[model samples]
Target chain A: MERKSSDRKARAPSGAAVQKIELTEALYRALFFEWAEHGFSALSLERVAARAGAGKAAIYRRWPGKLQFADEAVNALGLKMAAFGDKGSLEADIRAFHRRLRIVFRHPVVRKILPDIYAEAARSDEMKAISDRVAQTRRDEAKKVIDRAISRGELPEAIDRDIALDFLPSSIYWRMVVIKSSLSEAQLRLHAQGTTAALKSLW
Target chain B: MERKSSDRKARAPSGAAVQKIELTEALYRALFFEWAEHGFSALSLERVAARAGAGKAAIYRRWPGKLQFADEAVNALGLKMAAFGDKGSLEADIRAFHRRLRIVFRHPVVRKILPDIYAEAARSDEMKAISDRVAQTRRDEAKKVIDRAISRGELPEAIDRDIALDFLPSSIYWRMVVIKSSLSEAQLRLHAQGTTAALKSLW
Candidate 1:
């Protein structure tokens, strides 16, 4: 009685659908690898398909072009970020956020891919929209952390959410993203704790 | 009489050399504009030369090729940064830094070109060297700030320089560059004041 195939197979994919999903996952893996190695300007669909051991038609069936492919892939990252959950206290929540960000930043492909995304966003309106969407999702997630802290009375009711948002995640980002450096465990804890103190100044 | 004409213009440039210097400046300006508009991957030397109202010979006279042109221009930026002097206090110094960075980031051409530079750094060793040189210069400047603070007893003798470095400049950069937004004067003041408190947490 299901109208479209979308809801029907999402819960339990049959044999061929499972195979197709696996193939799609392979294509994504290959796409990111090639993009990392060559930079975004040189991303090749043929190479991605060949590396994935899939036909070009497989990509076309999923995405009309490279831009569509990339947009969808980056859009899927929102789900990756949504995996973050509440960690009870403000410090714990901020620490969890930094740890998760560090894991994503530590992935070599991701390190290579992020600057390209920023460069692409600068060049094209389409890429700008994708970049904005990714940022908005992160902010939405960040808001949840701030909201929980305020409710817990760790933060005051009159806090500047924008400034608090900046305080919550920026130091680690500047360290990992701008400096292209990894943080030791102690330093990560310091970022969590230090910012927990600093965020209070926002009020 | 002087060695290779390099010392000839130590004091002054007169005649055709003056004209040549102006043309070279124009070429640098045009090169950055084209790079900002088209991105590093699509940067075109021919377009740059034409936009400057110069010929291909003008470019060849300055450098061997596009890579050399870009490298030299980026290297010249070290002089731009060297213009920053000590502001006599830690917070004033950081506020000056943020003000300088804001001016740079606000430049339409610079805003467009920076991400491409980062992306290029990721993809090419030559670019990585250039990027590292720029970061090294900034760190050297940052170190001067921390040292001044330590001497003034604003910070302790045993502060963690690396984490302190992260604390000083990141919040504004994260707000400006990563989120791609501007800040108000009070918010800038708050960043300086807040970090003055936060940097002590590293000790």
Candidate 2:
């Protein structure tokens, strides 16, 4: 039995590797809950490992320190840009985008995590850079949607893309996070229509 | 000398009242710096009094507790709406408003205090409500700008006023606080133009 165990350790079985991946994911999940509740400044790695029901060595082996852990855990949450598809018309594309935004912002985890992240970003320059990168990535993806609309002759070539890119997310975030308004679906639809109308004129 | 002092106190002298007011203002000022640097959760009334060279009892007399002190100190900072003074066209009025916004946001106290306030707001529902009230007050003031433009025939009366009121500040806050981007005068001018153009179309 000892010889067989030694052989397995030497072979590094796929089962062990899969188990390690699961452990890492569990650690990240625990970290998210901890962060959402306590924020970055108050977070403890020991608490995270304990909450994850994993050993401290497991966390240390994955991340060198707290900041990297925070960055990775937040990145793992995956706030990627939504694929609105080719909605054909600019208004339709924007409405689809808004619909996706409403869903994303309304997610239980996203709602809790976002405010904490924003608060963390406000306090730390490193976190701010990470947030800016995330925003830029989303902006780049949104630019594609606008580009498609422009190619379809739905938008003017001279449309100020930079300002337009900032508008949608900014407005949604302002309403959802800052104002903490409980926007009904109809209200969200009206916002989408109003924004689309404004974009059409500007573009 | 004690009799003379007692007689003076009985008279309720204006000079004594002025000195007391000065001390109260000084304490609030110190509290602002402390809150800005350390944040609300970490703020200490003792430290504020010490910084202001005032008595702890004085602070206690003015505010029942740290939260009220923080609220009153922040409110006293006066983020009042800018008086754009009817710049004739919507674009010009927006430009003046933008200029004032730039100054207010760039103020050292505002720059530091705003992030801390946001961080606190994320943590506390009370802070969130205070922030919302401040935003609503500013929005009410901003509505007058649009009302004036509508009256002047510069913007259409049919415009969705609610969304437009949210747009300017949301965009500015997104750029300044979330993205942490520095805006040049030229960029501000472009933003002002884009927003005005959008409003024109929406209205």
Candidate 3:
């Protein structure tokens, strides 16, 4: 059976697998950037094709339209576990989260893409879907930290876990967007550390 | 002094002052929202003229262009003191700040204008200049609170005052824009209390 199987030829790789593969991350980044810069109203197939050094038909083959392409690009930049810390303490976890947050917040893509996505989300279901998918994981990870504190009796029994999770991130973002300050390393650490302490009673 | 005042009045308000005198707060708010929504791309003499219920000639007579109008609106909406309280302790004072912040944060103008201003600031030097003017007072006020805490030994001398200020508001804004979760009264108190406790050691 092994000999026969080894001799047998396999089928060619499917289009979905091929679609998932990119020749370079740069190409992926270029596509994400163009979409973020222009948004749905201004984004065009020709422009993305030009930026990525690919033919319009190539992108069309992988994505049905600009919306689908956006989904794929955002997925490539999705949040991850390493983004937050879990060193058996809430303070450590929050510090890790802010470090990751500062990186993301300072990224040109986030500055360009986030506002447009937010504005468009108010009007477009497709964009809203993409926004929710991208944000869900980070929020969930934050909530998990709160839950762990509660489980370990590190926080008070009556604390509201969800609200506690939101405290640090919300403060950072409000300053970034509304106040438009240059975010320093010290600022990030203070926000993380201070918020962790403030909300610990809830655990 | 009376003669000086009469002479100054006889000279009439300067061009800018005359414009300010003519503009009502509601009209100012409407102009601000319109400019924020459209940027320079969508703004025009006719639109603001219509929104303000004035003729095109009236707005042109005052602002000269959308940019000038935008400049005035930016200055008009700068951070307001939402009342202050001497609550007899650092925790109470911090809590008062959060209460004021909640009011400031929830204003439709603040919410709508900020993200747009941030996005524009990245691209437009003029907007950047105007946004900085708007943001400075808020930063100063926040710093004042930290200074008060340090004086009372509520926070450690080693605490970086600037770092302490950014913690709560930044986190709150992040939750507002990214999560679309309303910052409730309960959340504000929780964040305020938690962050103050964390920084208590530094006091």
Q: What TM-scores does chain A show, candidate by candidate in order?
A: 0.79, 0.80, 0.76
For model 3, state the Cα shift of residue A56 in Å: 7.0
Cα-based lDDT for every prediction? 0.76, 0.69, 0.64
The collision pairs in model 1 are none
For residue A169, model 2's alpha carbon misses the true position, in angstroms, by 2.1
lDDT of 1 by residue, A101-177 (tens): 77777777777778778777877888888777766756777898899999999989988787888887788877886
Chain B alone, candidate 2, TM-score of 0.79
Across residues B1-203, which tens digit of lDDT does each residue of candidate 1 receive?
Answer: 11223554555556536336678779888888888777777677899999999898888766878877887777654424543777888778877777766666676666677777777887788887777776675677778888888898778999888888897768876777666777888888777766766776665
When 1 and 3 are scored with TM-score, the better candidate is 1
| Residue A158 of model 3, lDDT score | 79
* Tens digit per residue, CA lDDT, model 2, A56-76: 988776777888777776677
Q: What DockQ do you compute for every candidate structure? A: 0.51, 0.29, 0.29
DockQ ranking of the models = 1, 2, 3
DockQ of 2: 0.29
Q: Which regions of candidate 3 deviate over 4 angstroms?
A: A1-69, A79-86, A119-125, A171-190, B1-30, B33-61, B77-79, B83-85, B201-203
TM-score of chain B of 3: 0.76
Selected candidate, larger TM-score, 2 vs 3: 2
